[model samples]
Target: MGPGPKVKCPPRLAPCGLRLVQVRFPTGLTSEEYVKQEAWRFARLERCPFHPEGGCGLARHGTYARVSPPGCLIARWWCPTARTSISLLPDFMCSRLTGTLAEVEAVVAAADAAPTREVASEVLRPDVELPGALRWLRRRTRLVHAGLAAAIGLLPGLLARCEPTITSVRSALGAEVALVRLRAELVPHLAALPPPLGFGPRPAQRRSSLTALQQESGTDPPSGTR
Candidate 1:
């Protein structure tokens, strides 16, 4: 499976073989040169997951704005077959969360380590005006737990013994990197799960473990590089 939000690309630039064009910008390309650089960045794509009929259906669909990382613009592509757009996001961003992956990881780690509600509040969001920081914490905590349960068929002993929050999960794992492990273990099917915070419009109507369930059920495909 792909490591990023699902979207496919660039083949039939002809002699380059058959595949979808990558929706990327080469390193160091300034915003000023964005349009000019589009051609080269797309050369590395695999295939359009939506419209693979003739490779002519995928078109530039523009970008989305980001905070934390100032001036960031997420690239997107339009798929006529799917009648919807799919965009690629870096590993540092979660599929539906508003914060960057690092930002989310840092907050989780801090919140997990603090021992009391006061400390947890301070560690997660020093200022109440930051609104949604704590909310994101709650939502992501559940997301991690659900993904873990779906993947391993059980929660760590400590978490099972206490509240099933990231704070508890971290304590159960007794490791500093538990959040990272959770993020890494997370699969795309998260897109379909019930959002602990709330729901937005999306195609994945119900939860299905794209990778973890298959492995747990003994029906997983061969291990290979993502």
Candidate 2:
């Protein structure tokens, strides 16, 4: 069948225009429970976040659903002056990625604990083919490494002394819930970093998978792949 036609991704909703505000949820809060109780209504902005001087006409913009946590609604606010919208995202929900932060952490933790990316893929995602699984795992690992790097730069007093590695981070902070702890610590500065950790915009998508895979392994790209 030669090569299949490329699939088109749906247009992102206001890529640069949307900002995120992290909100904490009570323990054991499920997506279903969140929707049923109309939890989105609870997230409120007293004044215009963009224009705190007073009079920017910030209004409640309704809610948006998340794909991972089915039925969960994120509350939104619109600013007329800035022409941007802010979404109140619950901390449990991963910012840019689909699944929750806990799920993302599990994937990365498993990969880090394993001997190699190849080994980790086989153990953590046996259902997926090796190449596909590596790509999936690589994405999470790269994003997390980026987030950790940002964390270190932002909190130099606490983290600057430590080496820039996940193991070092886990050792410096809590082992099991390092990502969760980092998220809470980065709450004030979330706007500067990108998601799964913060609300900052994601970097541009790479065009070449082979290059990404090569970069992930820190090896020269194999001949004949490109």
> Model-by-model lDDT, in order?
0.43, 0.67
Residue 60 accuracy (lDDT) in model 2: 73
| Candidate 1 C-alpha lDDT tens digits along 1-226 | 1123333433432223222222222233333243344422342234554445544465655655544355445566655544445555443444455545445555655666678545676566666533344444555554554544443433343345645455555566676545444434343333433222112222232344233222222211111211
Best by TM-score: 2
Q: TM-scores across all candidates?
A: 0.50, 0.72
In terms of lDDT, which candidate is strongest?
Answer: 2
Which residues of candidate 2, in runs, are more than 4 Å off? 1-38, 165-167, 203-226
Encode model 2's per-residue lDDT on 72-116: one tens digit a residue.
677777665555666777766677676677788778878888899
Clashes of 1: 15
Which parts of model 1 have CA positions greater than 4 angstroms off?
1-45, 129-136, 153-226
